[model samples]
Target chain A: MADRPGSDQVTTLDTPIRLDYHFSAGAAATPYLRGLAEGKFVGQRCPVCRKVYIPPRGSCPTDGVATEGAEVLADKGTVTTYCVVNVPFAGQSIEIPYICAQVLLDGADISFMSLIQEIPADQVRMGLRVEAVWVPPEERGPTLASVEYFRPNGEPDADYDSYKAYL
Target chain B: MPAAPAPRQGRRPVAVVSFAQAPNVRRDTAHNEVELLLPVIGEVLGNLGITKDDIGFICSGSTDYLIGGPFSFVAALDAVGVWPPKSESHVEMDAAWALYEAWVRLQEGDVDTALVYGFGKSSMGDLGKILALQLDPYVMAPLWPDPVSLAALQARALLDHGLATERDFAEVAARSRRSALDNPKAQVAYDRSADDLLGEDYVVAPLRRHALPPLTDGAAAVMLAAGDRAFELCERPAWITGIDHRVETHALGARDLTSSPSTAKAAEVAGVSAGPVEVVELHAPFAPQELVLCRALGLPVDPTGAGSTSVNPSGGPLAANALMAGGLIRIGEAAARIIDGRVSRVVAHATSGPVLQQNLVAVLEGA
Candidate 1:
């Protein structure tokens, strides 16, 4: 194979860099993301307020109770609101100008942000129907990226008031 | 809707009674975060005739990415000798926010006094790339736009809006550096003229080397006690009369870079009324930021007014930018004014996120 682009050349310049990091797995968020990779969405429900969190948190924000057990949620959801990512960032895998939407899945009280792909950026509506597209079963990771991106489900447009709380 | 009963604003009565800090140097090879903080915390506590055990609560502000480590605050806690497992918390924000959290805890009435500290070693990492992480992860990060470039964008916008000039920015830097000469703890202290600064090459458009802060490694510790308890500790306690913080949307392109609405909103909520503010310590890492903050606070752009709130008496962050610790230092410097009897009333300001996207302001008074 030919030498890779940019790697084929050598230069005399040396730029010094350093990494000083203390790594904590943020272990609490692991199981929730893990559930997504397994084709299921899990959230922790607060016993006091009975609010189901999609990306289950360790503690409930309102009642301040520890979340217990897994509450699987329906993968299908309606887009609440979204913005087009016209700018790109470091370590980002997605291309620029993609739609990042807040999807409120069924059986979940709150919506989470994720990328919406396979649709025109300008055409992506606020209440469009979308479904999670999971990665190949053998390549799952403990991250939201495990679900590649939400795709258009070709369902009827959701009423604005139906998912207005998510915005 | 009848004024909502004042929301019980909690009665922790915490005032910053004592503060101490080390000289912010560009490189601190002799000490790490803990080593830099231990003595400062000791000195601050000592000044109040108290010990570490006297602190009922502890909180720290720091970022893991600053030193290329996650949970960097955890290791720095060893400096405090937290053996008895104190009621403590950590914010990924600046230590100034940590001070705010401590103030909130004091309101609960359970904690009489709290120790708040912050430290950062920006020398150990790529400070610019690390700061980019503070932006929206999806859209802004992929462009790899370093902080200097973003600050330049703000400077350009200010120029386009005719709100300021490149010479104005250079003058701010020159004055800040001159002010730092009086502050022994300042990292970058030099006597330079505005014309000389304007002659330097631009690191980014409209931002010269003099207009940027020096990368620094340092730590600061502040002691806060509630109400009468504060009066007992110091002859003049910097009573935090009003404190509030607010955040704007993280999207850079969506924000108006020329103005810090968050700072103005926070100042408004903190009850920064129009008056002769004796001293105002603002955390402006970039020189142009000082102008933006002054405008947001409704203070005169020039620091020469007799009753004007003197911005950055400790030379501010342009003297030394220590990332997570810089904001807390501003509060400490403001509190020092009250302790030294130099000012009867002052305001301490802190900021986080990119382009002044979030701000916390506290109006302090000597009691």
Candidate 2:
């Protein structure tokens, strides 16, 4: 190997990233989050397809049309499917062995994932009925987490045929 | 501005004459991006018995996030020594898309030949964290869901829909890695069975370790010459018959996770079904994604067996996935098969974003 001045020395740079960003929730999501703070389930329906999207979207994906009006939906939903969290990860908020479910809220077209507790991870299955257990009013804010997690609402399990399209 | 060149009306025949790529590696501590690309670019043009001045336009594909700096492609151009300032352009997508751009430019008739390349070094940052930034910033990025977890969600959906099983995913990985044993440039190659791969624990539930691609640092280049120029450059050039791309909604929940409808749309537009496909190269980073793409493109579910349509003969992204270059490598690899007189018709696919959200398909034929 050819030698040069400081050839035996190795230098490295440690660049720590620190940056701030402000994101707009957009025309649809701003109102949805605000409604969540007030303990309300807000969604929008596509005028063409007539399918409702919760935590609302500015545009309907299928019909390529804007969803203008907001609709308040029920807090109850059915689990379309779920995955059992067996391994731990960095920056993970939920505890190990927790259940993460794609909950299809009533009157909503698309499902969103959230934590499911008060039920053993093994017992969580598709079509299981559930409802949001919101935080106390004082703790409510502009976050979906205001409804901490979903729990079995004791309603009969939804028929598999109901959410077959969603899965 | 100078007077615009006259554009050709119908499709102009453009053929991939030469292709080359750097050895795939987990981490390249010795060379930076330009250093990794210089030799690959040189070899691709040199092998064709031509110099950079012989090309009319040069285009590259790369991303700034991986470099942790903006305008990284500008420095990558230094590898080609783009003196005299030849016509050039860039896309922040895979080099396959850059090849697509160059092909479109060649259709203008003025430019007889063009060069396309893609490069990336995924070793520099936490790729999982960097990839999360591509999601919807307001609703999804705040949660910071990793790509593996998102792919697992899709995998689970595929399972529930009766489209595939966990064993099927393992088989794809096993076959890909086994095929990679024949490829010297492959980053991760082994003679493992599907059952042995199935014994591994899930990285994210439903996705075993084999389902994931090895993060790679590599570069690849392709030379495109139009019509008679293709005949002048080589004996058998992989002439591009058709090329098209399609993208789905960015919101993960908005589209059906079980199927890749965008790939289907692009394949239809590219006339992938017009003729029997002898060789197909797919850029599926995840093993399960291969099944999804095959179903979308109307190809065989298991793209194995020598007589049938051979898929991923170069071992594919499952062997060495170098971010932006992986897709372009599929193109180069497919072209090499045709150039070597092993195949006549070939189909190559490239995917970007997450879970096969965006797809580009090209059909290359030998004359």
Candidate 3:
């Protein structure tokens, strides 16, 4: 054995932190979620500026005031913008060549992101009329997943001038 | 033509006009961060008889790690309306840093008023373990040493080095809790004696339960105005006469835990020694750290005693440790004393990282 007592060596220790969290939604989403549980789209309009917001983001970005008066919205809406997902990556849940569109619901001031289906991805254009295809009532509860996807609503495309401001 | 205002070298006076805080609680189940901050922001602004429109720049301090979401501060903006797009910024550190940014912005003379706010909910996750993520990711964070154990090492250093006694820590906790009786927002407060507190079980060696801060969910907001606008807003504004912040080496082994040189350096630059301190509010999460901070700030180890300056009159962090907001709340508490005319001059210190790796010092005075 070596007589020298001191040696330069790095000792490594393994330490891991596993933390669990209970996620709670903000106050504004509580009511909106209740409507989802009931198979309805609930949104609010800003009190200062009567801009309706489906899936209201607690407040109006333009006015910066809490949205007021829960207003149930229609399942059908117009696509103000859209993007075709053609790139493939790991954990790709959906098949390639799907469409992700920003749908501006009727009576809503802002657009919310949603998937478009039942039509060709290239056919999913701005100003496309789409309706929420909901899961069976038994499978639905307080979640956006309640709606399977927005498909063709068999309605004529609205003129771009009608939803130009949203773009 | 007039020599460009002589190229002002000194700081432009910025006064903290109002401060409001939500009650610190172990759990705020009913309200999220936005809802918790809304009332505090309202009260802070309403205290000055003003609104969001009155603030020129809005700065906030918070970390997304606590919220488990990216860009959580964006949603929190709803509490303080940013409509018409106010000049706003945010920091991932405590709100005291946000106040620092606002102070620097005020120096530009473009923003006459600033609103600084911070909010956090430690009860949402394992605050102890989560804090480890802030350690040196390469070596220290991998060890997952929670904040309490790290602070205990510092406390043990104090004890071993004869810097302080266990009774000193108890006294700090006792005095802090007693002071918290007056602080309505404090999460924990009692009239227990120091000796009794000394008998409590140790959360970590040399650090008793009393010495450790109670985890809290809280939010606080403060308003600052530059020059004459401060006079119009608050009758007795706590003017920030001097402010500075410093950080130590990131490697835990590279610095001395027994003494916080960064805190002392910050105190020096912040002109804490220049004035007669009447109130000193410190963001010391543990009791021993309070002694370290007091000594670093050039105050007595027992700063809580009935001395010339009252230390932690708001119970300090031993009462409520709400992470990102703790430091800013210390500054606000000190400024509140000055605003209330209880003190002419005060020193407020805020610390971040493990065992006071970073420190911020500010001197507020009534003008």
Candidate 4:
């Protein structure tokens, strides 16, 4: 026979599981987020490499040394590189076609992803000048969401050679 | 560049005497992780006419993220039926690294034979979203940048730098899938033209659907025996001549996306260019990545041609990427060819992290 008996056929089971976890902000991140609450950008400088890390990291990935000394950085930075996100994904909070730019904060050596808004998605290019647009003071918290989004600051576009290494 | 730590050399000869794998599929709803791995483990030992008592050590590779539980690998040990007591270990990394650990253990002369396995069922949860957790928690993870999107950015950079083109990517996919036709374990075997592949729309810019590896559920195992034990176990054992691994900074923007310097460094320490390679099993999950790896390993352009090195004869990861197990499968596939007397010298490679940030290279030789 082409078909198998119902009992002889294989059975499949579905076990639903969920994992809920709470991650703590370490020593470097605790102060970084606290600074964000007061509308200031704080970064950590690697003494050996002399490179500034935005949002601060406990250890420099290159030197494997615990970074010390907090460095306050300006809000404006250059968009080193970016991708125009078009696909929708589960747990995604932003609208499609939004620009995710890797912003290298002024005086920071590393770049981090943030939303680029108040400009057309196609116009959001590398080397574009951008500044943070923070949420209202009452709504501000010790989270990246404290900055609503970044918008063009209308400064002259940075030259390719200045931020080429970041790309 | 700081030299990659060299693997222990001039040690007792160890060889992969046996290898086995489960059929790769898009989904296997009928079995759980333990159920899925049991038969695969049995076949590996059964084919060699050996059992747990004969194996000196046991190691496995799996990710808790796949099953969404702590110590998932501990439960997987039930498949091995580790009764009484046995020397065992586990790695959160790919099984290739587990094999590396076993190789190092074998060098101590305490273990004569070792068994290594890796498995992952990517169907249980949001595979892309789960992998995104591996990114930096402070910045990258908060944005939830999926693996494919990150790889696409690498592909875009490759194009911007004039390292590769969209057609070149399609060509790699076409060749790999076509090569998988003879491989029973391949899940995406096909014979299609590169032009037809290029006709497909982009899942992410600069990367067409053909360039992506298919999501697969599978398990693979390799048995390693040292010196006399290897000759007794296999007719012609694939001896481990050299092995090494190297890693780069995890910051994606800190390194060049168009090339894999870590792989090149690993290959140098592994002695990949010492002899003529007859086969290469590259663990490149993306099409363009294959080109990058080929250059890194210094393989000839016409790799698969007659009298030249054959690349991915088992179809590589493009056909069926079983997450943590995929990299280990490359090692097993390469050894199987040597055991079968099809090749004399072979190189197997494995990679981890975003955009090939880390790489492992191992050279195998046949008598």
Candidate 5:
């Protein structure tokens, strides 16, 4: 057994454990979330690199340039890769064995992390076609949860090597 | 091509010339990490005949969560007496990574010598549970699987693959503890045999208490100087020829835990296989991990051979594992051997995250 310094302290704990955190409220995702409330999928494009980003970021990771000019995605994309989340976690809204996938919207350089639903877990695979399932027009909020989940598009599977790096 | 950035050319080339550490104990009530580090830092600096003021840069590796606090490294700076505000930086990863950052800063040409340190106090909290946070916070961390259980899973995978046995783990622990007896800084140093360790019960299945590193509270430091400045500072300078690091995917189930491909990739980039490695210091937190790392690095098993590298002459992490600082101490130990003229060339390694998810390797030589 590991040694506890205060072994004699069998008394009830006095201090209640409280979860307190300070998050960066200035996240660029805020406006994107606001866009989702209006039934719009917004993104930003880098002027220099000419790359479009979904769920707009403040700066590009590779070029380190500030993104500019918002653009709307077509609300459709191909599933790059995905996993069946057989396990659940705290603050998770969905049940176990749900699908989480990377969706690469057209004209975007990279894919974004999202949930997949309205599909069987065993059927999920790399390059499995998928599309966004937005929240009710009235219920959308300024968060990634604005989009409820992604559902299968019934398209042919993409080549294994094509999306391998995204995995 | 703009001269390929010129390798940060400067007036001097710096390398880690000397390193030292105190044994990692479970509970360090005898002294705080700062108190523990003061003397060791002084000892390492003294070997190079340099004072705190002589250091142009200072960097450290540590995590605040280890002690249930934030900005722990900031408090540790007091131990080094940075009243005048020296050029410094820190990493939330292992001290070995801090050393790498320092090496990169040295390449900038403004800094000639640097002081690197790492310390951890694992006795304060449930270290296993705290380390679990190092995993993917969304999916894996919620399971609350402690580090031991994950390592056990890896061990079982290795065992099932016919790569090693439970006996191999026992032998590594026994040898580590026994070898640690010669090291004054060792915490769990003992002269026990593999049979004695096998008698103990398993802490986590497939991982006996001996296979797991002792929860140690300790600190370490190393002094580095550039080419001519290093040569002028000591009779033999441990020149760092190459250093590189890589990280694996955060998902534990997604990776091949039985092999540390990150370590192998780091070794390749650090040029560990470029020439003969006379000595090696591997940062394996678990006994079986040492075996896995050895195979990954392509190092020989024997300790006595021309081509065979002596693994963990300072007993490595299995003897006294201080979470944040263990990796940096590996570099310090390997460099110390060069200062003692025991080896001409050596490789030092450090690891972080669950099951060696991230690895850093450095190749050092005596000049």
Candidate 6:
């Protein structure tokens, strides 16, 4: 059964609310941000499970223990998973048909998302070796953009068994 | 619905066995939500010589607006060390509502023990802006009225109608601060007299500096167990005999500000008057709301603490009010007295939303 509006008395109004806030990246990301400023990569190691996390989560996600000891990580890693971006929308910074992937950094227990450039979008695949390309020294600061993007390192692709667990 | 609902007769018995809270502080600069709450959870579970495995269910309450981020409760779960994936739930309101959810789950009989906790940091953001988002979106919230202004309006109503005097508010603050001398976890505690507090300037008419709760960044937790599990863990378990919650009209103009009919209705449903209430804990952030609550609940007042019933021996919310945890702390404070063999019957109340619009009442007893 269906009912249609027959000169019904219903009024519609639009209301909008805006709230501004200051965000802190918290204890784990603070050190990581500092590391980025110096063109260095760092991670936190979970004492309970010994899993190293990049951009260092304050607590070990699996064991829920306060992570200790910042481990310096390599800029090179394997692409555990990836997608080719084709759609264009508002605030589109990069050009279309770019590659974005979850890069499992060397010595990191988990994979993090990043952009892959300097290689054709179609060539980007799972287990591809990649390295961070730093921006100009003047542009480098406390941000992920300091390393403009990841690029193919021209090394042999990683073995399937190495990053299968991350997928 | 059953006419004139009778008291629960054959329901399962649940008791609060252990409780822990982070030391109340104006700001916890070094610790994030995970670190701030980790010790509280560890202490609550460790006090009973148990671990997360011993917990059957987990529930927490908190809002993300404090940090202006989403999934704050999920990040807060890191304090629990959730190995093997425990069954859990969360509420965006006060942790008292989380405890209520856990209590309802316990009534189902499958779960024997549950861990309930709440944490918040008011100093992280503009509390006034954060609180304004909770009002009626179309008509009320747009005004962007801060909480103290709203509480001041309620206080003004109390004064204009002679429901209470300004000195009575001062006395509530003075007695709360004085009683807090023995509480190691209170953020604000002193031996200030009511006459001294009256000397302070008013934040708003009928509301002074001492009348408002401190902006506290803290966390609190409670452990609940049913029947034998509770007795085995706690020497004197505070068995919760009655628990109920009720809500009233959201539009402030449609309701009375000087009285809390929602609290009265909730107290009735929870059977608060069935036994002598030896302790009463109300989550009244402003000192004047305590007078309103006492009037609604029909409880005798002895602010000097010489009478049989003691109110806020833990200094209540006037000492330290952590948004998400304030109400749960009230329940924990009341239960602690019963667990220590200090009291027989206690009524714990928690308020949420605007101007005490929603109220939860629980009656705990000692065998």
TM-score of chain A of each: 0.79, 0.91, 0.86, 0.88, 0.77, 0.88
User: Could you tell me which 10 consecutive residues in candidate 6 chain B have the lowest summed lDDT?
Assistant: B1-10
Model 5 vs. true fold: TM: 0.66
The TM-score between candidate 1 and the true structure equals 0.68
Off by over 4 Å in 3: A1-19, B1-9
Question: What does candidate 6's lDDT look like per residue over A1-42, in tens digits?
Answer: 223468454455456666676555667777887888778788
lDDT of 1 by residue, B193-264 (tens): 888888999999889998888988888889988866877788788888778899998988889988988889
Best by lDDT: 6
lDDT of 4 by residue, B1-367 (tens): 1111222364677888899899999987656566567668778888789876788998888998877778978867756756556899999988999999999899899879999999988877787778877776555666677888988998888889877888888888888899899899999999999889989999998889999999898999999988778888888888888899999987877888888999999899889999898889999999888878988989864422333788888889999899889988999999999999988889999988787988999999886
- Residue A144 error, candidate 4, Å: 41
Best by TM-score: 6
Model 4 ranges with Cα > 4 A deviation: A1-167, B1-10, B301-307
Q: What is the DockQ of each candidate?
A: 0.04, 0.01, 0.38, 0.01, 0.01, 0.46
DockQ, 0 to 1 scale, candidate 4: 0.01
lDDT of 6 by residue, B268-367 (tens): 8888778788889899999989988887777875445566678888999999999999999999999999888888789999999888999999988886
Better of 1 and 3 by DockQ: 3
Task: Identify the superior model by TM-score, candidate 4 or candidate 5.
Answer: 4
> What Cα-based lDDT does every candidate model obtain?
0.80, 0.85, 0.86, 0.84, 0.76, 0.87
Instruction: Give the alpha carbon lDDT tens digit for every residue of B1-367 in model 3.
Output: 1011111124578889999999999987666787788779879988989878888999999998898878989888978878778889999999999999999999998879999999999878887778989998767887788888998999999999999999999999999999999989999999999889878888788899999999899999999988878888888888888889999998988888989899999898888888699889999999999889988999977734767778889999999988899999999999998889888888999988889999999998886
Clashing residue pairs, candidate 3? Answer: none
* Residue-level error in angstroms, candidate 4, position B169: 0.6
lDDT of 5 by residue, B196-307 (tens): 8889999898999988988888888888776567767777777777788999998877898888898898888778887898878889888888888888888864322224
Estimate, for each residue in A1-167, the C-alpha lDDT of model 4 and write its tens digit. 13356666534433333344233344666778899899889888877689888776455544434567878999999999999999999999988889999998889999999999999999998899999999999999899999999999999999989899898
Better of 2 and 4 by lDDT: 2
